[model samples]
Target: MIPRLVATDLDGTLLRSDGTVSPRTRDVLTALETRGVPVVFVTGRPMRWVDELHDDVGGHGLAICSNGAIVYEVADRAVRRALPLDRAIVLEVAARLRAALPGTAFALERTHGFAREDSYRSRHVEPVGTPHGTLEEILDDTVVKVLALHDEMDGDAYWRAVDRLVGDLVDVTWSSTWALVEMSAHGVTKASTLALLCAELGITSAEVVAFGDMTNDIAMLQWAGTSYAMADAHPAAQAAATHRAPGHDADGVAVVLTELFDLP
Candidate 1:
């Protein structure tokens, strides 16, 4: 069956290991567009990171950013919908996180961009090109996500710590070794975001094919009609997927697209 819409996570699902979409992937995506299959990117990254991809995939795609905090229309570069964090709750969570991990670096994600305290440099010194702003100033705005950096924190420990600390107050997930905790007003997730997108496109969750490689992608994977986990995906993700595909380096998404959609 031809999927009416295709929704995929970006970092470890659609892009190759080097963090760029391969030429083969690009060709498959273009062919899907030609076949009238709407391609949507569901990611934990902010929309600012979507421009580079928009250029590659053309400006007609949709993006679910900040782990579903915001859905953007690439054609007009506008936010179609947003689920913002409650200022009071977010400020409280930030305070608690700071108290728990004194030396930890952190960033507050807004619909437009992300901000970090000057002290962030002491811990997460890696330059990811995300602009920095004071925590106080960021709290004054609508925060969509929070990223915490711990040099020695593996994915498991990171998730455990955040879950124990925040619990149901926020949604915690990881890509690589970085811990990304997304706080919403109450309940918001990639699956919910995709549901909204599916409604807009007249598609159903049963018509969507999703992919991923991390704990963050779990909800969406389970919500899709058929979900695929990468060969190198985490155990939880692999268990959640309907099927397992090749590793990201082996063009997992491309392989599935070719077989399922019969792309050239």
Candidate 2:
């Protein structure tokens, strides 16, 4: 059966290793959109980090960002929906993680921008946001997600340890190659958000195809009827996917979509 929708991740799945979309991939997606099958960029990136990607989506795709905490409408350049983390829950989670993993720093993803603790070290050379006071002082606004950065371990190791400590309390996931973990409200994930969007579009999970390369994409991949993990996807993501495609450098998603849709 032909898929009615295509959902994909950004960092290690859709974008090339150097962080740019290839023309072939862009053209194929445009053709897919023209055929009435829309593409959705489901990612761990905050909205502020995804602004430049508007055109690649052809001004028609919806972006499921912040691990499903936000749904951004590409064409309108507006937020269709925002699922914020509860202030009390966030504070509790932060305190718990801090106690368990001493020296760990925290950051917050606000509706419009990002804010981090004074001691948090951002992996990005370009800082994600300004230093707000301690996590306690940053609760005046709604928090969509929380970023946990640990300087003593790798991303995979940190995620595993964090999950073991706080997995039952909140949703913990990591997408990048840094020693950082992202937390969302329990039950909030890319798959959950995408499922809602699918329903709104009159499409079912069985009619959707998804792609990803990180642990964050595991749920989304498992939820889709047909799921692809990029060749270099994280172990968990690869195992969750029904199939595997070339890595992002090879335009894995485009290759799969072309075969699925028989596009030129």
Candidate 3:
């Protein structure tokens, strides 16, 4: 079917493992929009990381960042809307997880900045003098998502344990190969916010095509009428997707898009 909208995860689904967009992928996405199929990047990335993508994505497009917590206006570098995590909820979740999973370290993603405990090892470099504090010390109402980390556990294992402990209380999902899980307020996910936007645009779920390669992308993959898991997608993601696209390194999403739309 010809889709009205296209939703895709950035890191492991669209972008190559080297974390850059391939030239072919870039052309395909731009051509997709040129043909009137808009692309929305739904990622676990914070707005900070998505900044580099504005020009690459044809200058102006919307992105669902921090999973579903923030909907960003790409060219404008503005937050169109956000579903921030309540600080009280973050504190409570952190308290409970710390008790059950001894090594879990906590961090906060806010509208304007980030803060983390000394133990949370972030892969992306934070600015010097970024806040380093306890949850009680650093948490504020601006929090968009809560990050939990464990150096010893596998990515899936860590997510499972966190979900088992607190999934009933909040939304827990993992995208990183590392032992990191991002928690959103209950019922908030990439699909939830995407649904809101599509409704605003008068698009239906049956008109949306989505792609992803990890646990975090499962909900959207399932929510879309048509979905593809990247070739090396997580087992759960593969199971949720209706089809398997080529691997990210192979510019898989682009391959599928070109075929579907008959783009050059």
Candidate 3 local lDDT, residue 194: 98
TM per candidate comes to 0.90, 0.96, 0.97
**Pairs of residues at least 3 apart in sequence or in different chains that clash in candidate 1:** none
lDDT per residue, candidate 1, 1-264, as tens digits?
677888888887888867898988888888888788899998887777776677675543888888888988876788998888777777676777778865556677677566777656433333466666667665645678776666556657766786678766777666655544445545678888899879877898889999989887899999999999999898999999999989888889999989998665
Q: How many steric overlaps does candidate 3 have?
A: 0
Residue-by-residue lDDT tens digits, candidate 2, 1-264: 999999999998999988888998998888987898889999999886778777676465889989999999877878999988888788788888889899889888888677888888877754544757788877645788999999888888899998898888778998878889999888899999999999999999999999999999999999999999999988889999999999999999999999999987
Residues 1-264 of candidate 3 have per-residue lDDT tens digits of 799899999998999989899999988877877777878999999998898776787363789998899999988888999888877778789889989889989888899888999888888889677898677888888998999999988888888889999888789989887898999989999999999999999999999999999989999999999999999999999999999999999999999988888786
Task: Give the 10-residue window scoring lowest on summed lDDT in candidate 2.
Answer: 122-131
RMSD of 1: 2.6
Clashing pairs in 2: none
Q: After the best TM-score superposition of candidate 3, give how far the Cα of residue 98 lies from its true spot, in angstroms.
A: 1.1
Provide the global lDDT of candidate 2 against the true structure. Answer: 0.88
Which prediction has more favorable lDDT, 1 or 3? 3
